[model samples]
Target: MKKKITVALLTAAISLSLVACSNKENVSKNEKLEDTVVVYTTHKEEMLEAISDEFTKETGINVEFINLKGELADRVRSEKDNPQADVMFGGDTSTYMQLKEEGLYEKTEPQWKDELDKSFKDSEGYWYGTIKTPVMMFYNKDLLSADKAPKDWSDLTKEEYKDLIVTRDSLSSSMRSTVCALIENNIKTKNEDAAWKYLTDLDKNIKNYYNSGSVMYSAIGKGEAAISIAVLSDIIDNKENNKMPLEIVDAESGSVVITDCVAALKNAPHPNAAAKFVDFVGSAKVQAMIANDFNRIPTLDSALKDSPAWMATDYKAMDVDWDVIGKNQSKWIEKWETDIIDNNKVEKQ
Candidate 1:
């Protein structure tokens, strides 16, 4: 599906104008403005630009973003003495859990509190979930027809797909969290041995592990890898924008649904502007815009009703405790690196 440019045209225009008019010798008046919001986000550029532009248009406050794919929390903690960003956006709930534990965010009342589900937001409003990004697998459409594609996570262990699957390195926090969920939902729920056995078996088919999700998806799109695991949004964006021949498979066993959350720094340089930006992004209007144009599952109930037909509606969220996952993250990673990973490498060799 093509992006609906009509929703964010002025944002693109303003972004281009800012770039084209760059002059170190002569700083523009807008650059000199004091009330700008500095955003640290993991959102894709398109999503960031659109939301920022609309915030600028409505509040007359400029938005500057620093893209941090998976390290926003650590970066914010490092900059605690001198907060560089007013807000952090688009990391998953686990990211927010860490931030909340470390007291990195300020509790603020969001405009969409009533519209959002209680489970999706922090009880005290430290962070809020904006959209649902499900964990799923995709295959190269050119190489595998729909009927031939793997039906679920367990199917990935089949011998036919041996050395044909790719995924982000388990070292990455996002990938690690995904691994934890897979173990929790697919294996540990029934028995630990079953989960370990499944992961070890699946590892046999992993031909490569990518450092970045983008590179992994690119490999699958180019048919360099026939199958890969990724987020639903990434697959949609790649197929629509890059014309990548990819098709998504909702894990028939059940899929873990995670959300991209937004929060404001506890000691933000621009506190009021940060609050405004957060509220604007969480508002029904912007959430609806995201749902319609980008095919993301919105957190707002009203936005869900307004979402585009292409956006999925009937997928079951895996029953897992995010708090338990967040607390045991380090231990899980250690086990993965020592046991699961070590065993997989030896077997493949």
Candidate 2:
């Protein structure tokens, strides 16, 4: 009887030990997962790397990112069933809105949420803006005098500017936003026909549509083209850092200002890490650092105060409904390509 009782007690103790071991293993695995974050972004490699390095240094959380440029959103959509990234960063708010509508984001209220205006963040907390980007017209000062340069989107279609305008491919986010703004502008005036007509006329003057931003900037610097359109940050970078003779055109019709944003993916593998990263990147200190270092405009009201003086320069902002643009963007790009770009290619051939 005593021997049987000893055997039963030993067996029960062993069973409890096994359960404890299994629980420890799971806790270890979760801790490992929390130590790393995977990111997908449209930002340039240099900028992404720098920011990620800072994040890792501050939080001891590793950051592994893929720079997908214009392909980031589509990639996220394809990976919806099994998301490969914990976070998505650096696209305009319109792209984020579309993704949010598809239920692809994890709602996270970053620490800086209340520091920004309602327009800079999604109302339900799905995404938040990190920077402000104004899509503006630029001219090579050496090639075309300020007086002769196109002053507005409408002026680009003028006969005198023929064969002088160069632009990024339609797939570029900046170009897409600009086109959508044009469409929205005309739609508000109840003249959609005028928008299509304007695009067709502008297409006639385009010297070349380069697929690469570096190549396009090179062409402008080398006098291959005198006028172009790009985000303000790039224009400032080229003019100030690269010594390119580019100057911003104070477009009479105003620029389409886009709020570049960040969000965590739905069902991300590391939800806690994603939320922490989102908060870190959009914080006032980080936003100010980005604005000062990269020539970006900050979306945070407090961060804006610390930004460079040039960011304070006044420029007209076109009134735009980003949600409306987000819903119609894909179709508008398709129509632009099919009607304007393809037809022009056929004419040239």
Candidate 3:
């Protein structure tokens, strides 16, 4: 959320503090333990700060956040021999999948995990899911012919749509995961050849390539581009609050959706505090706050019933077989270079 505080610097102070239950700092082992709950997250810093502040008020547990973006998994992997974070929060499911491989995540049994949708949570318990950020087709109503607006994935490849697609960079980014998911799940493809061909054609329609999801939305809203494969919550949050003309369509075929998940870290300095935060946030109370106030779609079914803004559509299907994308990550990236992008491709500002 906020810039990550230094764990190495604070480690000594916290070590000295935990040595004995001295009320010198005004909290003790028996009295809310002064253990710093280190959180590594990619959610917008504003949202993370709010959640951390609320959690502190409710439990009196102090939090030291390690906020990061884009290359978080690389940073965490480098720091794994001496892990700094107690809990990993936010970001797409694939990032967590990579972390799960590094033994960075601990097997935790949060009580709420059982209450979640089975597809959302990991079976071996290295990670758990929350919130529903579904893939959406965000369209600018003013820019293109009404016939150009997309209702489903297939609309992107129409004859008149030859030179009007916008996309993101695939090199070392989560955009590749979405592409990989789109091919592996939504396409009725036992035909990998067809999937490859579609990607090639989609590549040719590029009006521009964007580096940020926020920019993609802004570009679409300003009529700089016609549509985007953006998150539903991101689009609706902008529209409902800022009154942008952009709107999201829940395709007839389900889109690539994922949850913003959190997990206990392996070798955490404060396991008890970490587990408690996990259990706390997974509750209906926190999930509902995420839905109602923060624009996060709830994974808890009870919260879904009340928060229409988050789960307003009947489009419920999410792509399956995430392991295919995770396992074949590099090959898919290579496929992009081979079949889709080149130096001559549209450049992002």
Candidate 4:
């Protein structure tokens, strides 16, 4: 009884390089690429620069941004001597936790540390989630229809949906995290093999596999694939302003939730600016950028609204142990590669 595997709709698998430009739009001592503040992020370029520009407007801090790609953790670690980023923003909380273990964070500033969540945030004041993104089921409304869409976790194998669901390779860090949680819960009969079997069945149903997080939203939006698991942030942000019938669902069976946060490097070149960036993200205005403007949930209380539909719903999520994610990632990735992807065990519905 292998458990089901669904990739959360993360806003971006993007490496947001924040090149700080002054509002003056000229290279000056305080704002030039070499002289200005250096910030690093993996957020989408549009959102990253939009928010960074706002910060520049208010503070007059000269900024230079570099767009990063590939695994941020690897990049940051590899550049230990000449680390490029002062603040890492917009990655899953688990990555932050893993970095904290590696001693990457400075751990000075605190953002409602104990109050928001004891488990999620760092106790030493290293990192905190500025916005949250919960994992939920996303299906093409036209294909699934309200009645045909999944309302529960087990719906992955219904007679009608046998070959309708689509998902990522289980080896992906995003999907692997959620899968570990699923296995831990014994959701697939407390037997990991059973869980793998279920994943295989769902894998067979997938029409295609994607390498980028944005592809999920794009796929579902265009009806290229009928169903997928995604983070709420990606789905909502990519949601058409012109109008499209894309739909995201929260299952009574449970949805996995995660948050994207900001963390300062332990010896950041611009400590003052780094802390300010965290506070800025924590503010309602910035939170709104994540929620109303971007479709991710605000971490602060003021940004929340009455609506909790889809990714917004106040559901029971795993306590979100970043440490667990860091340790188990290699094991899960290896298993998924050998058992599924490498052998071409994956299928398309």
Best by lDDT: 2
**Per-residue lDDT of model 1, residues 190-227, tens digit only:** 77778778888888888777776777776786777799
Q: Candidate 3: give its CA RMSD in angstroms.
A: 4.2
Arrange candidates by TM-score, descending.
2, 3, 1, 4
TM-score of each: 0.79, 0.87, 0.82, 0.75
Can you write out model 2's per-residue Cα lDDT over 111-167, one digit (the tens) per residue?
789978998999999999998999999999898887788878889889999889888
RMSD to true structure for each model, in Å: 7.8, 11.5, 4.2, 8.3
C-alpha local distance difference test of each model: 0.74, 0.81, 0.69, 0.61
Model 4 lDDT tens row, 12-106: 21123334444445223462232234556556666766776776775655544554533556767766665555677766676777788888888
Best by TM-score: 2
Q: How close is candidate 2 to the true structure, as a TM-score?
A: 0.87
Q: Which stretches of candidate 1 lie over 4 Å from their true place?
A: 1-34, 145-148, 170-174, 190-197, 212-214, 239-245, 334-349
User: After superposition on all CA atoms, how large is the RMSD of candidate 1?
Assistant: 7.8
User: Clashing pairs in model 3?
Assistant: none
